[model samples]
Target: MAEGRSIAERLSGAMERRDEAPNIALAEEIGASGDKAAVGELVELVRIGTARQRNDAMKVLYEIGARNPDLIGGYCPVFLEALGSRTNRQVWGAMQVLDSVAELRADEIAAELPRIIEAADRGSVIAKDRCTSLLTKLARSGYAEKAVPILVERLKTAAPNQFPTYAEQTASVVRPAEKPGLIETIRKRLETITQRAKRERMEKLLRKLNG
Candidate 1:
């Protein structure tokens, strides 16, 4: 009460109150501030704060990365760890950031492809979607031939829920030399994808691939 401010006011810096922090506008302001330490602060918010805080912090991180990846790129490991978080927000949030910075650190990130594959199997659908995009990015980064077999295996064994998704994403990275094998893998899995909608999607993909 030194200055007669309310408790919420005095404690705002700690952002303990859910209503007090992770405000999108505030996050945007911090992102636009051009402060070099902003990434550190955002990382703290994501790691220690609530779900809303984590989501907003990542939004700002990607927004900053959009302008200059170097500002948010070096924290790739942090984002990769975030993938293991229980919250869907953090998982997909990390994916967005990783996707943004992957080009700059492909070799380092590509090394974690196994973890990435596990996340695709267990994380939220959007998380898996982002994972597929990252995998495709990795494939394009000179690992196409190696990644093709792993992705094909994923497609063959994917649960019905994720069959279409993995199929769709795998199709995008099937290089000309790899298309025949991927097509064969997809065909073998067609009977397993008994769900009509998903089965149709796979069929459409095969048609597109001329398989």
Candidate 2:
């Protein structure tokens, strides 16, 4: 089998050919081997691989998330942005990779909430769902409250298609856990609105008194 070489070597060879099987195998081996040596190669793959290859490399990074989440987490924003810009169906796979990376590297990406929301707001339906889900996760995980404004904006300006998906994600992805239906999400979103209104009202009252 010409494929025979240490897993790293085989993957290097495969990367030269842009071969899928070898890339997939290399991804698996890197995860299993926890080889720090492979990190540079993986990052390079992220830079140069075709859409499929880029997505595949991301999966490897996510798998490596199981071992060194910090390293894996560091790449989430880059991959997320890159994947979001893409229109191919393969972007779904990239979204999945982002999801896994977000889970593992929760702490690292926590500070990028606003950017995440902006990305979601600009994304396709599926990309928006994935980003919103991760945002909800980050919020629940105690990342920050910055995402609230974006969510509110989405609910406000949502089109027919966008609103339903946004509503579904609010139910399925934003909450602490998956809720059964849209009613619950609606209820929760209403609660969020009420809270924001209260805060705004208080600020208005404060301005009147200070004036």
Candidate 3:
């Protein structure tokens, strides 16, 4: 007595529903699919679907990446485009998805060099750090020269004043299990940078003025 269709069939029917809940359900089923057909559907979900639906699709795609390495590579552009909108939680989710995707599809997404560079240069520290880590992984995987320029540019653009605030905020939000040494580590790292290095240094001095 079959109470429901197989995951693939249910996913196919769900894809036609146009509702967010069905789209999300389809994403879940696709994760279960791990079959070749799920790749295109997952890509569309990330590209044009609702944010929740995109996150779900990204999760499935990341799971698929475990077996079909190229599944994530095919959507790097869409992932990067989503990341450009920093205010969206979906953007952050996309980044996490990209990290997994890059781990699996390292060679294929090498073409994302420019976006990777820009990401390291201008995004929030957490964002830049994640981009830096991905580029570092890419380097270790055999693109050292390609990743170096991006890393160097990122270091060059990072502001000294922003580092203190970044350290403080990071310390406050970091999990209690991590707070003991993480705050000190971030503070020490930020303190070593030259204040004259960036315009944001003035912000740090202003703090002294108010103090």
Candidate 4:
């Protein structure tokens, strides 16, 4: 006999169970839902369910966003609203979803950039990671006029552990016109980056950009 219900069935059931911990496989199951109306169910959960349910639902929605962002791209507002959840999980989790859908929904997100930055600053390191990444994604997708400077400013003050990873992605998005300003911004911070590991990473990135 089969050991359990189908993933979709289990996820559907899990969505209604507000008192219990969410099913770990819910995100994967949401992806397996063929990018359909089942997404609305996940959206509803994120909008009104308990905190654990909302967190899991956000995870499921972002899983869908990651696999086919167009599936959940229109729900950008839902994720944006959850940024204020009392729980940090929903807050940063929403940011992560926005990050996954940033390029796909850049027009919708462009106006919300400041709120995104504000949420990240008030939330956690995870929130900052995804928020900065979304800003870079928008800059890459053509909001460079308004987006690149914010990305550069964030890079200037990012924690040491972040310089290597986040800067790598941000570097790839710097347009030729923006490169000079970005390089100068990073170089100005180099004299202040006291961490050897982070300083080395910034130097390496600058070499590639300067070259």
Candidate 5:
């Protein structure tokens, strides 16, 4: 970062670096400094920069969001639009940012559930993971009536390796009326989970939920 270079100019995209350390460091710096101006530049790069640059920009945006979601809450629409991006990195990165701010922007996010669900259904594992996190946040933030059923459906078909964690997260916000369905879902999936540790986790969750 040159003394006089703009924050955008100091990003990994402008520097043309291949590694992510610089981008991560820049994200940390911008997050710590609470530089709202850099967010606009990063969002622009995410929208129009080359693939590498877009990835770096998205990374920085989400990193900043992770530290203080309120700073990036207003950009929920940008993240939602990125769900339609053909780039897998951008799609998942957008999902990650959305997850970070989902609680703060729950109502806005709840309204975009269709697009969010569509992206998660076809996107990368990371995208799916973040989507689960996003939905969980929405459920916890008082949209459980709308988010939990969808979350339960996702849990039913979630990748076996990822099911336990998703189930655990969903459990936290499950309403009493939804618990039976969740218990049934977990019980049915338990047989297919070959890992003993994961099975025990699901079983424990079942026990906790049942009680």
Candidate 6:
């Protein structure tokens, strides 16, 4: 609130606020302004701030990325580094940012597939969800040959509640040669999916793929 207070000082952690509304409002403000300097400060905060500070910084960064990914596109390294963080919030927040910019920075993301996949394998549901989204985006952005197989692997092992959505998302990008394999994976999983809606959705996907 004081004049000349740095962006870091204004963050929720720095201000010692328990609520995230201020942080969300700040993210919207910074995102709308397209202030690269603020983005730089936020990135630095993610690197060296306290646990709460790091969380707030990541929240703001991803919110900015969501509004205008190009504004955060060049910070792929920062995001990648956050994947290795001890803090779960930082990891998932970074994944959200990476997902937002995956298509815009496809080459950079393609080069970091191993790290991304590793993070997804050990990460929370939100992190895995975003990784799935990132892979699908890459699959559509000329990396289908490399991304589709990984996507299929993820689909096979996805949580039953999430399988139908993952299957639906992967369906559009699958090549003809991949269809039968996907269909088979879906069919095998169908028995485990007790929810009528989900089973029906996967069955629908199978029908579409079969035609």
Q: Name the TM-score of candidate 2.
A: 0.54
Q: Which ten residues in a row have the lowest lDDT in candidate 5?
A: 1-10
Backbone clashes in model 5, listed as residue pairs: none
- Please give, for residues 145-203, the per-residue lDDT of candidate 4 as tens digits: 78877777777778767766767777887777778877887788778778888888889
* lDDT per residue (tens digit) for residues 51-170 in model 2: 554556655665565555555555665665665455443354445556656666677666655555565555667766666666666655565354433454565555544554455444
* Candidate 1 wrong stretches, greater than 4 Å: 1-35, 50-52, 63-70, 159-162, 192-201
Where's the lowest-lDDT run of ten residues in candidate 4? 1-10
Q: What does candidate 1's lDDT look like per residue over 1-211, in tens digits?
A: 2245332222334455455343444434444665566568777777786666566677667666666676777788888888888877777778877877777878888898887777667877777667767777788888787676677776666667877777788888888887888888888888777788888888999999994
Give per-model TM-scores.
0.71, 0.54, 0.51, 0.82, 0.95, 0.96
How far out, in Å, is residue 154 in model 4?
1.4
Candidate 4, superposed: residue stretches over 4 Å from native: 1-24
Cα lDDT tens digits for candidate 5, 1-211: 3368876677776787777778788888878877788888888888888777788889989889889787888988889999999989989999999999998988999999999999998999999999999998999899999999988888989999899999999999898888889999999999898898998998899999988
Worst 10 residues of 6 by lDDT: 1-10
Q: What lDDT tens digits, residue by residue, belong to model 3 across residues 16-108?
A: 644445434544445455445567766786777665556556555655554455545667777778776654455555565566666556775
- lDDT score, candidate 4: 0.77
* Between candidates 2 and 5, the TM-score winner: 5
- Considering every candidate listed, which one attains the maximal TM-score? 6
Q: Residue 146: error of model 2 in Å?
A: 2.3
